[model samples]
Target chain A: MDKALLSTRNLHRSFGGVHAVKDVSFHVPTGAIKAVIGPNGAGKTTLFNLIAGTLTPHQGQVIFRGQPITGHKPHAVAALGIARTFQTTKLFPHMTVLENVMMGRHTRTRSGFLAGMFNAPWTWREQRQTEAKARAILEELGLTAHTNETACNLPFGRQRLVEFARALATEPSLLLLDEPAAGLNIYETQQLSQLILKIRDTGITCLVVEHDMSLVMNISDEVVVLDQGHKIAEGPPAAIQRNPEVIRVYLGDEHA
Target chain B: MRLRIYYPVLATAVLIVLLHLALAYADATYYMTQITMSAYYALVVIGLCLLMGYAGQASLGHAGFFAIGGYTAAVLTTYNLRPYADAPFVSLCRALGLTMQWKDLYGTDILSFTPWAAFGSALLLTGLIALVIGASVIRLKGHYLAMATLGFGLIVYRIALGTPVLGRADGISNVPPFHLLGSLQVNGRAPFRIQNYYLAWVVVLIAMVLALNLVHSRVGRALRSIHENEEAAHSLGVNTYRYKLAVFVLSAIFAAMGGALLTHYSGSIGPAEATVMKSVRYVAIVAVGGMANLWGAMVMGILLNFLSLRGVFGSFDDTVFGAILIMMMIFAPQGLLRVPRLRALGSLVSRRSHA
Candidate 1:
């Protein structure tokens, strides 16, 4: 492997007695697009949460860029070059798309309450720089037309794009996207796959938890198949499609 | 960019001047007393607005902070330290110029802390208390948060009413005036009323300008992000807990500053200012002014408080505020200025041109 940018070792998380993620282990190479796919209740989302620091693993470690980051808070994880989007579109509804992107620049900026309240000269300069960077991100995502519109006013697919733009504004080395295609139409899904490819080409690693099989198969450089909180298979997208175990898990026992 | 920030500030200055000129022309300068008092109350509203509006934290304990500030200043400035004049702490305070010698109503010489010392102590105590309270409670959300803060307010109220040193029901009186500079002072005497009115308004304007700057900056954006969705903000590297706690302490300081200055201006600090009703009143004014609108809160803070101070609502003052709260919650939860109908009205007129 080309030096894994992120690795989960023997991760385990449970809600009550039911194991949501059970002794799962995985790794993603630097600057690659990787996908974790499974049926409902297969522990994919739970696994993502554990890596993103939303939930602490009962056992095991998550190493990012050679450093163990297990049990860190979400914000702390984000500050260390990991950014994520929620399964649901969690855009700031009342804020404009431009402002939403600007919020992602939070950790990158240094102006605090006192500097802000006093309207310090540096804060003004920082604000302008943040605005310019945000505008550039919006343009890259082709969301410039909707820059001034409130985030919630956008259609579901467009809102997803705005969120993607926001996550990009954070300038994270690794982006964790949760169900980016959930509410998107087929056309929008295709657009999202293209965006994901563009993101990967930029040398940023992507770890995506997805449902749409075709979207995953098309864009993912490698695929990890999860079943009942266990890693059933992991390989290139082509091999995963041909794997007998993945087929059985997808089509039931008789079909296998 | 600078123009966007300066115009509103300039306009507010003009408005303040116009209001004073109009009051003087109408021979209603007597109303300035209530106006001046309202200005102080408005300070509390400004702080609460940031908490309840931008930060999306409902604090029903702001009056507790105000009382903490007022009582700290009142107790320090009025408590006789002459008996302990030889004590090291008292002598240290004297050497530091923190203590002053003045005559009481009976012409007795009394040694106490100066207004400056009292004011500094009030803010320091309020900030520390706010940090402790906020650390424990800022993690809570919605009704849980509201109830927790209400409980804090009640505790402060009880302490103010039951603590003998705070004068129980009679409260603390004989608070000395705060000397701001060479001639300017926060005093309630008739000769100082006009100057005091100007002083109070100037303080309010400075606060407003600072608040404006805050809300228009990056910190404001982060606060609004937290308000919209805390988890998402956290995912984006905004430390939601730290922001909430910081804003809580800042708002508490603002409330305490208001309380301390008002106590000095009135020459008294009372338990009534610490009551649950007072906190609710602050909440009501913020709601009526539009929760997130600083200017709206400041205006309604002064207007509603002035009316109540002038006995406009008669003996039903508390009842009137309670009713206003209920009405605003039901009829215009978005606040008077942000009512959907108002926006619809504007759009309706614009649509008429198309028709």
Candidate 2:
């Protein structure tokens, strides 16, 4: 059996009087696409932040590759090979699409202040490689034509694609995408689903928090359902669709 | 470095030469003194540009760094060690060639740290202070950062005003000339005016090359990313705090470098150099230069400092700087050169060249 690549052990968090996430435990096996689905205010985004280190879990732990990584800062988590995208695209607006992706290569590149100021030969070589890598990522995402345009000027769908290219540029083993299909059109949503599956096939595990059931059910190998900060169901995508508790949470009691 | 960045640096060198010729033709070589001083002031502005425009950090108390540099050099090079010559530390410094004996105007013998020794210590002290301040200060954003730095500047100014060893209101005077190598030296004397002018410009041009290279490379991209969206940059594994602190220290060193050089050139260091108004003037110059444009900052730094030094603003220097800050913030926040009309003109020129 494949060991879990990332696991949460009874993760718990609260804000003021409200419990954002309580006793949430799940595992993403290596090279699998796992989706966390829930209704509004169900703690999906909070859970995502906990894993990405934007928020600390008041209880329990986040384990990656069999090592505890709870409470690590966002940048430290990123350096440890966990990359994420925001629910609302947060690309550097003034930067070009290529530059935005190049930024993702920050951890991978080692040239810093002294080297940059002195124009060291190795920095020049590293920069050339960084640009080539960014361009390759853009080309793979079919964003080559838009690479030079400012990120804010791109169409919303293309902007989302750029974010994907940026996350991919980080070359993460575990990628966390928060609502990657949120504002996308139906066609864009379909393309995103295919892209997620393609990413999984490329040996990068994916843990996605998304509202679009079709996209999740289409690409996810397994699904975990949350309702009001508690796990309601966990199973294969087809099993999740038929889970009565998930149905009740998605629809009201009358529909159930 | 890219070949393109070399062009501007070369052009700046050529312009420096032409300006000297023009001044000689007009028999206005006296103006070279002010221009040389402005070049030193430009060093502080470019460093501030890196902090404010690129790294997205605001330092309202940069004059504090300048004053720290000036005061360090002033206090070290001006204090007479003749009385303590028998003391172990004084003798050690003297044995290390760090002390110089010279005659004051009254012809009395005085022993103090050499200008080179004083300059080195000034840079080291300024860098250490910036590091401590930045460790906590760079965590602040926007107005809070500005206010904190301003407070720091005020404290330095107060110390300069109240301290006895620093000369208090009288400041430090009769600082000896900085002797670089045989005959080549930094002093306000008439004979060395032309040489000092070239010396100052060469320093500015070298700083410009280093700054331009920094802004175009990987570190530059990281800084711009931080400026645009710090959260996003952090999530990409950029250590934003470390980068901010590093730039802060580097910029402080730049200001101190200018301070040390200027103090030597003018043969005096004063509490006025640490004034809040002086700090405000630097911010105004950076704003006018277009926050992110290094070349623009250098140009505006020289132009504004020269005008102010030549008494072009008469007695309204502080008022004029404050007004410029307010006006730029309200109207052309992108800076004078980066205003839409000029930006469009710039694009037009680029397009024509391409055609």
Candidate 3:
């Protein structure tokens, strides 16, 4: 209600005759950590894609920061303060970890081609600043020692952290993380939860599409329950835990 | 801070300058002239390196831009205007402000303009054509992009061959020789190969410096990112399409400049100079030298050209070049310059205990 940072009005998407997403509507309140959870085929990822401009809906619209962003390209949407991490880590594999993070700062850097080519004073200053900021982020994520290592050479858990650092480099007001906890072990998941809370403390809104219920329930301020592409329930984590429909669909009848 | 980088660059510069002076004094006109042409080819290879090595774009139509530049210089220098009845295309160009003067209509064989003016005009014309081509075809990627550029090159070659005023398949000859500004009267004489050699070297130096600056810039980094993963770069808010177009256009301009300088030095223009095979030769130069290393391209260009001139390589230049490219791709795809020995050399010296 506090001026939702992102809102969707009956977003719909279809792949030929199969309806992938059906009239799904949701609003992500600004600065809140929210999660969308459902079965694998219940359209959680599709919904995230539609909101992030990766897929255009067959009907309805997505509004970000009070402006229509329904049909903007992914890069254009990202430029307008929406950044996402892929479900599978999409690190620039050949680049050094620092360089991979530095790419996220691409849109923020103010130097032009001529200035960069000439190594102008302003461009050099900006380059150093960006690198320093990238290093700081890596340090925070415990990846400072791997700054010069190529992304592909890092262990899987650490690669995910690098991906998060790269996403943070974009300085996004709204972060759309796709399964940030997938493939992460128990220790990594705990660290990821702490990281998410730290991110939330920075006053940035997060919409996480995750299947790790324990992680989601522990960190999310609010949870939106989806069953077959329609919202079945939405509330604080405690209330959602007792909701019968959520129990029948997700928590199992035995738990109920 | 990096003595390895500084010392080598300094030594290379000193050697080049001493060699140039020796050639000037010893009157080794032919070898100096060959070095001049090699220098121009090196410039073209530098642009090709940016396109193929860093951006991961392939082009087989660079010869088209090269030929266009050659003809542009030839037309401006020797045949600015032709008999009206014989050359309707020249007449049209004259009317369109493409050609600078209408000397034939004035019943004068000589039109007044400095050699430098003609050179500048040719370079400008080459850049304009490359801009148009780049805008039209840069949207394409992969083999389709290569085929589109190759088509453009063939079309330009055909135009140069068919247009009678443009030398009608034979190309124009007896170009006015280049002169050092204010120092000598070498125009319209036996080719001033020595002056042209120095001129070509100057152009090559400028191209090398420009390329070195570009590879270290943000645009260069953006291009390398796009090459690695386009979707990831876009998701990070990089304008991938615009950067691709910018590199394509810049590479074409460099190729055009190289062609213009080569034509001026040779004192002739030919359709064969801008053939599809010639374009592939440029690609091979960059491929063998290492795609990401600009200095490697320079070394390979000089080596390839030197081999060809020595008659040791003979007409088997393409076969030998192709073999080297294949070997590089298989054994050291990153290029000879990127071998681990070179990377370890600096660290070895610094770690004195190990050394």
Candidate 4:
């Protein structure tokens, strides 16, 4: 078996006795697209938060790139070649779409305060390179036309694309996307699923927490099932589809 | 690039022309001095604009930095140890024909140094204090940050008022005038108010240029990111805390340099200058001018300072600013600079079409 790009060991997080995640352990293999799917309140988002350093686990360790990164800050995680998009689009508003993505190139580039203030030649060179890289990513994501528009001014579906482009600009080895297709229509969903596959093909490991079974099952190489803070099952998408426990807890459980 | 050079050069030439006009009419009168005083306030407001406008952080301890700068200048300029000095440096100073100039006031001998030295030391001291204090304080957001900064300002104000060596409420006076590049003198036995006026505006211009360069850089984008959504910036690999602290300390340096120069120009210092109200006025000036627009803040600062000096709006300044803050927040909240969002877009489209 190939080494996991990211691994979590028995993670536990609770809020005022409400356990959001309990004894959750998972691993995303390098260069593979993995999805964590479950019912609402199944602790999928909370688990993503723990891995992204938004919250510290009560009992667990998150290992990334063969290094323990438990309790590291969000920026530290990003600096360590891990990047993520929020459940909601978290792009900087009042900034141009290109600028938003260019910001992601921060950790990848080096420039000090004085250097930036003075607009040193090296700073300009780095900035031009950053802009070129950002524009290329934006172009690849079909967002080049709106590069100069304000980020928030974009339509919801387009905003999500912009965010994905931004996360990609970080040059991350691991990308944690929280429901990238949550607010999208079926067409947009299919497009996003295709994009996720494309991202994985680019040699980036993807850990996506999504509710759309069709989107998750279509693109993910492996799917982990969660319900009420417990991992009920984990396997290939076809096996998870056949697993009776996942069926009972997630797919079979329907809203009245 | 030419546009950048054009605007700044045009601005400098215009300010110089205004100074030329003022110098021609003025006989170095008290009113002329007050107008120059307005120039220094403009510098302080420029600092606040960078802080509140771009970084989206409010500082209530801004005046604390200013007072720190003032006192640092005062100590460097007025603390003479010549007659009672037993230090070897004092003898060396006399032997090398570099004895610091001295003055006598209220039966006390005061050591006076050149203006540039005082300004340099003031900036260094204020920057050091600001860097330490800003690291912890800028972690706070919104009103909590404001309260923390206010607490710092209050603390500094009290220390300056109660501390004896700082001259308590009186503050250190007889601050020596600085000679611009060691040729043009400002405020001494043969004081030159025009020189000081030109010097003050020149500093303001340099500061403006620095701010322009900053806002056009990657650091500027990083700062605005911290303002809009700090967590998003952090997630994007921006050290939000570090950038916030950097801007805080830089803005404090701006205020500190202004205060240091003003202390020298005014030829006196006072603890009253460091009061919380003064800090709020700086905030008000930035707010009224539109926090994001440096030029707007500079203009409003000069205009308001003139009004306050003329006794036309002395006590009413705060009341007017408070009302303006309320109205602007309600009507234009992004800032006084921008009209309502729809109108702003409408204007933008209209202007674009025209262009």
Ten-residue segment with the worst summed lDDT in candidate 2 chain A?
A247-256
Candidate 1 Cα outliers beyond 4 Å, as residue runs? B344-355
- Model 4 DockQ (Cα-based): 0.56
- Could you list the CA RMSD of all candidates, in the order they appear? 2.9, 2.1, 4.8, 3.4
Candidate 3 at A102: error in angstroms? 1.9
> Which prediction has the highest DockQ against the true structure?
2
lDDT winner between candidates 1 and 3? 1
Candidate DockQ values, in order, are: 0.63, 0.65, 0.53, 0.56
Interface RMSD of the candidates, in order: 4.4, 3.1, 4.0, 2.9
Regions more than 4 Å wrong, model 2:
B336-338, B348-355
Q: For candidate 1, what is the DockQ?
A: 0.63
Report how far off residue A50 is in candidate 2 (Å). Answer: 1.2
Residue A200 shift from truth in candidate 4, angstroms:
1.4
Chain A vs. true chain A, TM-score per model, equals 0.98, 0.98, 0.94, 0.96
Mind giving the per-residue lDDT tens digits that candidate 4 earns over A1-256? 2399999999999999899999998889999999999999999999999999989999989999788999998899999999999888898877889988898898898887788667677777787888899999999998989988988899999999999999999999999999988989999999998999999999999999999999999999999988889888898999998887887775465520
Which docking category, incorrect, acceptable, medium or high, applies to candidate 1?
medium
**Model 2, backbone clash pairs (residues 3+ apart or across chains), number:** 0
TM-score for each candidate, following the candidate numbering: 0.97, 0.97, 0.87, 0.92
Q: Which candidate is the best by lDDT?
A: 2
RMSD of model 2 against the true structure: 2.1
